[model samples]
Target: MNSEKLLAILKLQATKNVGDIIAKKLIAATGDVEQVFKESKNTLHKINGIGTHVTDSLFANENLKRAEEELHYIQQKNIGFSYFLEDDYPQNLKHCIDAPILFFKEGNIDLSNQKIISVVGTRNITSYGRDFCNQLIEDLKDYNPIIVSGFAYGVDICAHKAAIKNNLQTTGVLAHGFETIYPKTHKKYISEVHKNGGFITEFWHDEQPMRENFLKRNRIVAGLSKATIIIESAKKGGSLVTADIANSYNRDVFALSGRANDIYSTGCNNLIKNNQAHLLSSADDIVKMLNWDLSKTSPPKQKELFVSLTDIEQKVYDYLQQNGKQLLDVIALNCDIPVYKLSSILIQMELKGVVKPLPGKLFEI
Candidate 1:
């Protein structure tokens, strides 16, 4: 984008009371970010959701000054950024109603890959959560998914490191600005993260990491992916907030189930019990639910020679062979297997070259 347009976007972003939704409304009404300023206050007021306070803030002298300063810093540092309407902007995030109009980024980040998933959880991660996060990424490496996390301690950092170890792209969404790293201890991982993926933030270069900022950051994490996985979370925490945002966006949410009595598992258990999130058991659950394996466009191969199958797997394979092709739910009903268990079984069968998934969740042997 040109300096003039970026400056206008920054100015609009700096305007108080004009958040992403209101800013977008203003932009749409005026037909351009710059036009928002050119239009008279009376004209802006006529736009729905536009009130006196928003119009008043739109032209604030301080906003323009701050915009100018940030714009200069952006130019001097040669920073990377994407406007909401730009093609380079995250595709999944673009669908969100309240997504930021612009967000700054650093490193070799790529969003063209649609197989993205955000994994979040408590900062005080247990060994079990850590092990699960590691194994999940390892199993998903072949699918080449872009792992996303908050870049905090515990589960967040664990997910990023696991992604890096598995040689998959991993993005760290930051609550603060690029100028400062939050935990200071995480600074060492910055170079590796940049080498593998990068970092994204909606905050300006000098914005501090505040309590409220973390809450606001959760939405971006939830918005940028097709699914959000809560590896662990307390009854009240930011990860749960991300889950809520993801659900609101109509995105798939999976929570790692733990014992009911476990403190950190309470939030995930509640989410599962309340029907807010699916119970996440293994990587196959995600692979099946998200249809990641359905990307195979080639013709379905016959079952591998001399391949061994468990009794249940054999039952499912026999049913599919006899029925030709059938919907997942239908196959589950006929085979007397629960949908959840059937999903995992189908994935296992697919990996063994016994069956392939068609569009609309149909499977054939």
Candidate 2:
């Protein structure tokens, strides 16, 4: 068939016993995908995680046709891929073990960059998060940086949108395939991204967006960039996954401060406390990390913060700012308020024009 190296890689990705167990082991023993097929089944069993059945499949190379089919489908969709050893691959991401063997992309982006920062957080973002993202990315835009993110919701959308608005290249790594975009609502922005920036994925076409894919996607978000910034993430947010990956990769990760006692902000604060991430209150912190000379590009126009309040109101306001619209119960949990008295406070806050209720029992600030 005169199959090429890319085809071989496609087949390797198609093999059995390759799901999180023996994929790395086989790569270690065989030294690469092509060599894995060359090794005898008996010989392959010597690797730590590989078993007789896995070695047998390694010898038979049963998935070659499946891979060829996948490659054909991938080609039909016009998705592009870059191997770790290929010239087009992001050199920084190459060092990551969990790095995709092939990155499927559709967009305009200078994949090669002096610096990249992955900005991520919750999908239910607040005005504060929106403001933080706007200011932080605006400052870093002059660096002509590549911004990496998952392109999901909340902070990811904000980051990508800001980068595009600033005319900076932004890459959104996807959890699903190019064949289908999860949360199709993002098509407008993602299309614009492809026109300028690009979308990337490891999974081939027809791959479902299993929740784990998001976890897998976060590694690329963390690895592809020089640093990672958490604008507003909850205690168990996926942005923390990116931070964890960044720390593992020995990359710089900055987290913006959230209001005291807010669940969404607790993750960033904990990251700062554990010394896993540095504190970031303004755009200056990000610029300092890249050490870029911003005199080159036009400085980003800043946003105006509307209204002010005392500490208690600020706390309530800040909580609303991160959660977008939340139910009264959610508000209570977020603000750590006893349900009994939270209603009067919320009502007062609403009257003050600090928060407003929406249909379906939600409030936005």
Candidate 3:
């Protein structure tokens, strides 16, 4: 984007009471970001959601000053950014109504790979959660997914590390600006994260990682991916907030199931029990749900010859082979297996390379 347009976006972003949704409306009404500032106060006020206070903020001289300062910093540091309307912006995030009009990024981040999933959980991650997270990324390496997370403690950093170890690109969504890294200890991982993928944030260059920024950051993490996975979370935590946001976008959400009494498991278990998320037992569940395996030009039917299946698995395979793709509920009813039991059985068959999952809960041999 040109300097004038960038400054206009920054000014709009700096305006108090003018959020992404409102900024977008102003831009849409005026036909351009720069035009929003050029338009008269009366014209802006005529737009819905633009009241006197909003128009006043939009014209605030202090906002333009701040925008100029930020623009200078961006130019000096050679920072990268993606405007909402630009082709470079993340496609998944573009669909979110409240996504930032512009977001800053750093490192060798690539959005071309569509096999993206965000994994988040509690800051106090358990050993079970950690191991599951590691193995999950390892299993998914073949698919070369872009693993995204908040770059915070526990499950977030764990997922990033695992993705790097598996030689996969992992993007960290930051709650603060590029000027400072939150949780000083994570500074060591920043270089490695940059090498593997990079960091992205909607906050300005010097913005602090305030408490409220995390809530805003969660949406970007959830928005950047095709699905959101909660490895572990308490009954109330930020990861659940991401899950909620992902759900609001009508994206798939998978929650790792743990023992009911486990503290961190409470949130994920609740999500699954409430039908708000799928019961994720393994990476196969994600592979199936996202239909990542369908991209194969010639799926390896040879693996089936060497694979072994339980009687129930064999039954499901036979049914799917005869019926083509079938919904989870339909397969459960026709095969005399309860839906709950069939879900896990299908996942196992998926791991054994006997069946493939399609979108909308459909499955095929």
Candidate 4:
């Protein structure tokens, strides 16, 4: 893009009170990003959602000066970037209403004909979470999906490392600018990450990794993928926020279930219980739900068709077979079993291949 257009986008990005949605509105109203500045305050005010405060911020001289300085920095460094309206921008993120209007990227990152998913979770990852994250990435390597994450501790870095070990591309979404790396120790992995995939961020060259920036970074992680997976999470954390954002974008979400008493598992269990995410037990669940091509890769082994079933399992299996598909609550009611007991029974049946779990607490024979 030309310096003028790039400067205009930077100014719009720097403008206070003007978010991605508002910036897009201004661009649409003027019919061109550069033209937005050319239009008079009166003309710009005619656009819906463009109030006096927004107009004031848009025309602020400070914003222009900052944009010019950043533009020069970008030009001198020969940095790469993608505009929301451009074809090179991530297609999945382009559909998000709150996606950044412009963002910077680095390395051999390529999204063309790629299957992407974001793996995220609590920074305090347990042994189980780490094992599952590694196994999940290794198993999915054959499909060659681009793994996306925040590049923070625990699950994020674990996902990135697994992808690297498996020779799969991995993208790190950052909260700070390219001028500095957060968690300074992660600086060691930068060269390797760039070699395999790379990093992306909306923050300017000098921006710091503020508290709110991490929350903002979560959106990019969620928006760039076809699905978001929470390997593990606390009762409340940024990973859950990303899952919510993915759901808002109408993307598939999967949560790994853990023991109910485990503190880290509480968030994931709640998501499954509330029907906010699919109960992820294995890689097969993702492949099946996403309808990925099983012929191209070695599929996971299925349970024996003639496996024995317990008396309760037989009763639930027969109920599911007769009903076709039923909700967990409904299944418990109809089978004359309590929900707590029925959950375990259903899980056993699922392992036996006599029952399958679907979205929304649904089960099928």
- Model 2 segments beyond 4 Å from truth? 19-32, 46-49, 59-62, 294-365
| Candidate 4 CA-lDDT value | 0.89
TM-score versus the correct structure, for each prediction: 0.81, 0.77, 0.81, 0.81
The whole-model lDDT of each prediction reads 0.90, 0.78, 0.90, 0.89
The C-alpha local distance difference test score for the whole of candidate 1 amounts to: 0.90
Steric clash count of candidate 4:
0
Residue 254, candidate 1: Cα error in Å is: 0.5
- Give the alpha carbon lDDT tens digit for every residue of 154-195 in model 3: 999889888876678999999999998888978867877899
| lDDT of residue 327 for candidate 4 | 95
Q: What is the lDDT of residue 115 in candidate 4?
A: 82
Off by over 4 Å in 3: 294-365
lDDT of 2: 0.78
Compose the digit string of candidate 2's lDDT tens values, residues 1-365. 23476776777677665653356566767787678777777777777777876665644545777787887887677666777666888888888877776667787867777678889998878778887787777666656788888888788977887787666788989898777877786765666688668888888788889999999988889889888999888888899888998999999999988888887898899999999999998877777776866776566545435655667778878888886888888888878888767776765565344676554668888
The residue-level lDDT of candidate 3 at 7 comes to 94
Tens-place lDDT digits, model 4, residues 1-365: 88999999999999999999999999988899999989999998899989999999998999989999999989998889999999999999999999999999988899764489999999988879988998898788777789999999889987887787667789999999999898886775787689889999999999999999999999999999999999999999999999999999999999999999999999999999999999999988888888889576555544235868888888888888888989999999999999989987875565344665565799987
What are the clash counts of all predictions, listed in order? 0, 2, 0, 0
Q: Which regions of candidate 1 are displaced past 4 Å?
A: 294-365
Q: Flag regions of model 4 displaced more than 4 Å.
A: 294-365
